[model samples]
Target: MATPEFVLSLREKIGHDPLPLVGVTAIVFRDEKVLIGRRADNGRWQPVSGIVDPGEEPADAVVRECREEAGVTVRATRLALVQQVPRITYANGDQVDYLDLVFRCDWVSGEPHPADGELTEVGFYGLGELTDVAHEHVRKIALAVAEDDPASFVGGR
Candidate 1:
């Protein structure tokens, strides 16, 4: 299945339109493992993330994305990082500039499974095993899980 037509239409309408899009991502860890999703579109591993809806807090969006992508309910502990990646080019040739807020979250309940169609697989992985992650920032977030600082956000280097 492809992305819903509504989303595609919206993307086309807003392509290069110069609007601020807010998104949220969650770094969920258990023991030494971090939850990651294999994106069906790119076949690459990344954290659970999605666009933040209007009027919703970034923390709420983080929890919602965790539940939707990883099939787990998580409680966001704190805002970990704010990333501003200017001009991201998508696979479809559209460009999006975004301000992303990442949160440090912990699983509160639910089982691990890929609930959203965007993810082909879902699992917890150790730092040593994450060789094929989609981006360096994601890898940094995974490494941050091992650090003593719980409030650190791994902004893009």
Candidate 2:
């Protein structure tokens, strides 16, 4: 897993302190299957996700992440959810609070494989075959595929 240069530079000053960042999750679907990967760091199955580059569009980040992480090309069709994830304290003691933008992407081309070292395995899976995936990701998938789908804001009620 490569840390972006900007984040690395920030960590030089902040050390292990909490850093707020924007992230994107690509819930890319090909027919009845959804793409997922086994994370190299945690070994947990998850959708294609990555940190948004400074000044980059979130939807473009989704497409870039899918290609960079999973070796697939996708069209980001919709914004599915926006939520703030709990802070993550890395093994190196660096902490991050991520505002996650989940997108529903349609597969355009390319077969899934681990394009980078971030994921050990990558492929499409049926919704029912996600027993190994995190419950939060499963919920994202459901929300992304719902018939009455619209972008959901998790807070601000």
Tell me the TM-score of each prediction against the true structure: 0.80, 0.97
Scored by CA lDDT, what does every candidate get? 0.74, 0.94
lDDT of 2 by residue, 1-157 (tens): 8899999999999999999999999999999999999999989999999999999999999999999999999999999999999999988899999999999999999999999999999999999899999899998998899634789998798
lDDT, candidate 1, 32-58, per-residue tens: 778888888878788888877767888
User: How high is the lDDT of residue 119 in model 1?
Assistant: 90
Top model by TM-score, which number? Answer: 2
By TM-score, how accurate is candidate 1?
0.80
Model 2 ranges with Cα > 4 A deviation: none
Clashes (candidate 1): 1
lDDT for model 2 comes to 0.94
